[model samples]
Target: MLIAVATYNEIDNLPIFVERLADTLPNVDLLVIDDGSPDGTGDWCLQEAKVNPHIHCLHRQGKPGLGSAIIAAMKYAVAHDYEVMVNLDADLSHPPEMIPLFLEAWEENDPGATVVIGSRYIKGGGIQGWPWKRHMMSKAINFYTRWLLWLPMADCSGSFRAYPVKLLKQVDFDSFLSQGYSFFEEILYHLKREGAQFVEVPFTFVERQYGASKISLQKAMVAVGTIFRLGMKVWFRA
Candidate 1:
């Protein structure tokens, strides 16, 4: 299994992130996709990758979108012959400890678990430290995506997920339209269209403890528009 984390300026969180992953998933290889963070996050990953054989870094020239970074990680995982690929945010919002549960879920299921999602809207799942406005907005986005895309899952917007690399290779990732956070839902839609089976695991999403949010009003607006266009495309195809 290959675990991938996309990072920006997450200097404060990287140490604990590496330590916990090492302690928990000692055998898994890690790919850090850094988009040229000004705070030396990429440099730190380079140093660690030199010392730790399990750690690898991909440095970009500038800050690219979240979607591109994960796509890059996916390619790396496939090229390296990893059976499964897992992606998470680097700001500690997605817990590194849940990796075991994801693996277990993937292994226990027969054929219907090509994708396992860490969902926040499920019964046992929840979020922490977010203001009511942000919380409500997240809920609204999930609801909107589920209805528009006719998706079965509750948490379509989440980035923390595990995918079988074979399932990932079935899709042409270069055809993906969304270049930011909206890519989460768009990719799920594409996978569902390919008849990929999915499982949702409940998890508590904690707010980032370090640095500011990468989301902006402009990005949110773009995501909304992208969702609408994707909805139309899927609806017409159906």
Candidate 2:
């Protein structure tokens, strides 16, 4: 499996995050997609990639959104013949330790199972170090999405996930509309339509220890409208 992390101004977190990821999955390769960050995150990744053969970095000219970065990374994984791809936050919010469990779930699942999500709303899963407002916002977003789209997922908004490369290749990436957080749920909606089996593993999500969250109140409000538009599209397709 190839682990992919999209980074933008994550200089403080990348070094230690990559170190721990290497310790957790010694053999798996890592792909870091860095958007041009004035903080020199791309430079750091390039320096590390030179010494570590398992670490690969893709540099973008500017801060393209998360969806585009992941798409690019997935393409790289596919072109490189990787059978599985795991994506997590560049920040420490998504624990590197839970990576093994994601791989285990993907390996042990039925042949049709293609996406395994690290869920915070499931049993034994929750978030730590978040204020009550943020927690409620996350819960409400998940609930709203699940209810409107008739999604069976507990964490549709989470980015921590593992995907089978073959299954991902089947999706029309160019048609995906969202370029930010909305992509999380949109991808799952398409996967569900493709009859891809989904599995959720309980995992505690930690708040980012290094940088500030990219999510803004404006983005959150925009997401509500985006979700409704996406939901309508999904409903019509079904």
Cα lDDT computed for each candidate against the true fold: 0.89, 0.88
lDDT of 2 by residue, 1-238 (tens): 7999999899999999998998898888999999897899999999988999999999999767888899898889878888899999989999999988888898898634569999998999999999999999998999999987788988999999999988887888898877777888888887887888889999999899898788988878877787899889867877
Determine the backbone clash count of candidate 1.
Answer: 0
lDDT at 124, model 2: 95
- Measured by TM-score, the strongest candidate is 1
How accurate locally is residue 225 in candidate 2, as Cα lDDT from 0 to 100?
80
| Alpha-carbon RMSD, each predicted model | 1.2, 1.2
User: For model 2, where is the 10-residue window of minimal lDDT?
Assistant: 105-114
Per-candidate TM vs. native? 0.97, 0.96
The residue-by-residue lDDT of candidate 1 on 1-238, one tens digit each, is 8999988998899878989898988978999999999998999999998899999999988877988899899889878878899899888889999999998888877433379999998999999999998888888999999998998998999999998887777788888888888999999998888888889999999999888899987898889889999999978987
Model 1: pairs clashing at backbone N, Cα or C within 3 Å: none
